[model samples]
Target: MGIIDFFVNLLKDPRGFIAGWIVALGPIWVYTPLFLIVFVETGLVFFPFLPGDSLLFAAGVFSADGGGLNLWATLIVFYLAAVLGNTSNYWIARLFGSRIIDSGKVKALTPERMAKLDHFFERYGGLTIVITRFMPFFRTFAPFIAGTGHMNFAKFTFFNVIGGVTWVSLFVLVGYFFGGVPFVQEHFEVIVLGIVAVSVAPAFIGVIKAAMNGRKGKGGE
Candidate 1:
């Protein structure tokens, strides 16, 4: 498939795409892209749109009985990918986040999103790291924002490990257990979309709430 088609397939049908990879790449080599996707999605703030949640769920499905992948291996690879990815993003931000944010180059880091992240940090404190792990766009940006001096390395790592393990385990095991149901097998694409929607709902809600608050402030003035 062409590059566009490749991503299109990945986005549209993560389960089918992953199953194809297991067949084509075999059990061992398939972990490379799995690792890379999770890594890049978490590590690179610009790639927040990547399918982190759905991909994990899909991998979990494939790791089921008679499925090609080993459950333990999948879990380990994802755990490492998630933790290391956040660590990489944290350092990148600690070193260059201000410059990157000021450069006006990353269109994804919008004013509203930044404000939302700030709200999370202020409201949740260091626990924001663990909380946002299940949130798609926020998860990608949380470490970067934390690394901008809102949090120190030691504290960040504590929540990072907790968040990574919890997030990966939850989605993967859910998929492993439920992916074979008749409804899920019949409507896998729909399920993937549902996962993406549920994962992104909080970020959308935060944006709406922020917009509303901005309006209220203007009215009070």
Candidate 2:
């Protein structure tokens, strides 16, 4: 009924929430969930609210046991998914980024916020692709901003590969390694929450840093 409730339902049963993607393209599609997950999480503008980090964490946990999904296959699927997903998100920005810039929906994005993200991408550059990959919610927007700014496509792609591979590898290996513990199995919710916190902490830190910087700059100006 409510936004939180709807998201809670999704968090409870991803397969149910992700049924459209699963049903439309089965395993024959090779990392179907990975593709759609990455696509919605990154590629689609309307889907900023989707579970990017948590889903990856869950996928990692699921893949740990080798549950009919080979580790290599999972990695390959997710890696490609993440890479393609960002590329797609970037182009989507290229296509419609200008249109949204002045819209009410984007009003939440103050110039200071834009400047912060700009400063981040500037300072980190392509490596933002790599570093933010490990970060949770931030990963979804990195490529989008890169594209919106018309950063070199070739450069973005290079880091996309690095980030995608690194991101998928860490989580899948994590799932593969610690997924089988009885305690983790019993307390999956706690684990998922922890993952969410870990993933979100970076964005939280970034926002706080940005806010502090904004205040200091204003005071100085």
Candidate 3:
């Protein structure tokens, strides 16, 4: 598996993964790895489940130390990654999204799912792209969808910048500010799990609501 895949899988046992990494990479890996992780996470839809929030948080925590990289530096690297990643995904959608969708290679984005996502992007437009940056599968698909729908580039960039900067700053700052606390250090995995769970909540709610409506329609029929 690739490096991102390794990190993503390690999230399944986050506590161990985080500890191992702080020791293994020391502080130098922080610079390039930060850029690469965010880039791939946003750029490649297949790697959506990779850890963005937690990774940033971890980087922030590292930056707080004397040997670690600078917090602002980390933010800059990842922010660029986020924007460029979506930009790449946007082009990918422009060129091949429909062809792939039409070919039925991707079963998750069925006609119904595609319609639902379109409705979501229309309702929220570029904000949908930015906000879903924190989300898992949705984050990966949002830019791709925007490409397919032919969302205006200027608008996409606006929200994309806001979302990328804000999302990176929020998590990184939080990790920098509070990462050293005994509770956080000890329960890091729990926190990561909580974040992941909350991140997926909207999608979960959507699925539940859809299921309920389906049941109601069947009953009425």
Candidate 4:
């Protein structure tokens, strides 16, 4: 199959794909692509649509079921991928943020959203990095905003590590414990979608809250 078809299949059933990969490619060979998926999802701003939470959960399930991927190694690889992804994203923002914003070539970086994120970073300071890690689209954007805003590297690194480790551990552990349940196994793709929905819900709520608050402030004025 072509590249697009290949990724579509993988995204459609990441759990099965990972399991098959483990069986076919073995533990050692599977790490690179897995790591790159997690890394590119966050590290490259243009590719946030890549599956992050489901992939981790699926990896956990594969590892738990005596698949080729070991439990501890899965966690470590994913955690590092996440951490390094954010770090790379931040540096990319620092280096090319203004040019990207000014050029307006990328459709995702809308002015209003960037302003909101800028305000978010300013309002929450360093913790935004940690908080957004569990939230889908925002998680990718938070570090970029931090970099664009010139947030201190030390502070960014501190929270980046915490967020990366926590996020990876949570989903992976969830998958290990619950992913192989009979119901879940039968309906794995639906569950993966559910996971993504739940992960993105917080950021969605936050956006709604902010919008409501903005309206209230306007009414008051």
Task: Identify the leading candidate in terms of TM-score.
Answer: 1
lDDT of 4 by residue, 1-221 (tens): 98678766777789778867777888798988899999988898877667798899998888776656788999999999999999999999899988877887767766656776777787888888888888777788888888886498899999999999999999999888887799988999999888888987876786788789889999999
What is the descending TM-score order?
Answer: 1, 4, 3, 2
In candidate 1, which residue pairs get closer than 3 Å at backbone N, Cα or C atoms, i.e. clash? Answer: none
Worst 10 residues of 3 by lDDT: 13-22
Clashing pairs for model 3 are none
lDDT of each: 0.92, 0.69, 0.76, 0.84
Top lDDT model: 1
Look at candidate 3 and tell me the lDDT of residue 83: 86
Error of 3 at 19 (Å): 6.4
Over 162-188, each residue of candidate 2 has an lDDT whose tens digit, in order, gives: 888888787778766876888877886
Over 4 Å off, model 2: 1-6, 12-31, 106-112, 216-221
Q: What order do you get sorting by lDDT, best first?
A: 1, 4, 3, 2
Candidate 1, which ten residues in sequence have the lowest lDDT sum?
A: 1-10
* Per-candidate clash tally: 0, 3, 0, 0
lDDT of 1 by residue, 100-175 (tens): 9999888989988888889889999989999999898889999999999899999999999999999999999999
